[model samples]
Target: MQTLRSRQASIAPLGIVLATGALLTGCGLAEDIADSLDTSNSKLHHVDTGAEGKESGLLADWVPDDAEDVHVLQRTTGSERLLTFEYSGGMPSECLEIDTVGSPTQEELAAAYETDARTRDFEVTQWSTEPTMQAEWWSAGHESRTTHLCGRWWVSETEGVFHAFAAELNG
Candidate 1:
């Protein structure tokens, strides 16, 4: 099974450029990312990170404690370390192409970072209901960060492969 982290390590740079380009054109970075996250025959796997399960890497520390229906989609590029967690009681009828299992709710997302606000490098810099509910963070090194989407999370890291995961998985 291919790992999402490894894939992200390869495409981090391109994602940054595209994200910046999209931002400049008022198209939005997340939309571009969503377009790139192809759902064709994509497979999602559930992980048990609880005790006795050796959870490693970004997902090990970033997934929220209350997150449910946690699933991961492995991609071929470094910017697509798709880790989706559903907190709502039931699944939504419709979801973005990037969503793995279902979708995410704003209220559930709000509770995700209510307790902890620190990731490996960046910190939660924005989280509000203005202009559509969204969340963003910034990194001290390489400017790596993440942006919360409708029912999932997207990471964009701009650093060496060894440190590329600093902002790759933020549940």
Candidate 2:
């Protein structure tokens, strides 16, 4: 009769063969697993500069046909997506502004705006989001004044310098 050790040794080779066969015939299982587990970092500014304002879905068309200096940022994960747009010279006010933050939270976006304001030596007034759904703030220093706006579905930040351009256009 075969001893227990002998029987176990005999099955070990069979296990290796079966595992190897599965891997060989599994249509790149390793690659598929790696891709599914991927959680790589994404930078908003790394997207194509030209393609920024030209994305084809959701908030893409809301920008004016004549808007200038248009910039866009988008992030997608499975069924969730976030989109942001910035442009200048729109109706009523030709303000240099960001259009929206389509994410669920506004912390990162607010921080970015504050950083920009600080860099420009503009004092950012407290942001307010009450009575109306919009959250808005401004920066004013020297010859520069700017406004930033955001809401649950939309947010816009604009440089007041363009108000003159808007008045010129409307006048």
Candidate maximizing TM-score? 2
TM-score of each: 0.25, 0.25
Q: How accurate is candidate 1 locally (lDDT)?
A: 0.37
List per-candidate RMSD values in Å: 20.9, 14.8
Kindly report which residue pairs in candidate 2 clash with one another: 97-157, 148-157, 149-156, 150-155
Model 2, position 58: C-alpha lDDT score: 30
How much is the lDDT of residue 6 in candidate 2? 100
Error of 1 at 14 (Å): 50
Query: RMSD of candidate 1 to the true fold?
Result: 20.9
The deviation in Å at residue 123 for candidate 2 is: 37
Ten contiguous residues minimizing lDDT sum, candidate 2: 162-171
Return the number of clashes found in candidate 1. Answer: 6
TM-score, structure 1 vs. true = 0.25
Backbone N/Cα/C clashes per model = 6, 4
| Tens-digit lDDT string for candidate 1 (41-150) | 33344555322112544354434445444555444332233344444322222222222222224444444434333321333333321111111221232212333322
Off by over 4 Å in 1: 1-43, 48-54, 58-60, 88-171
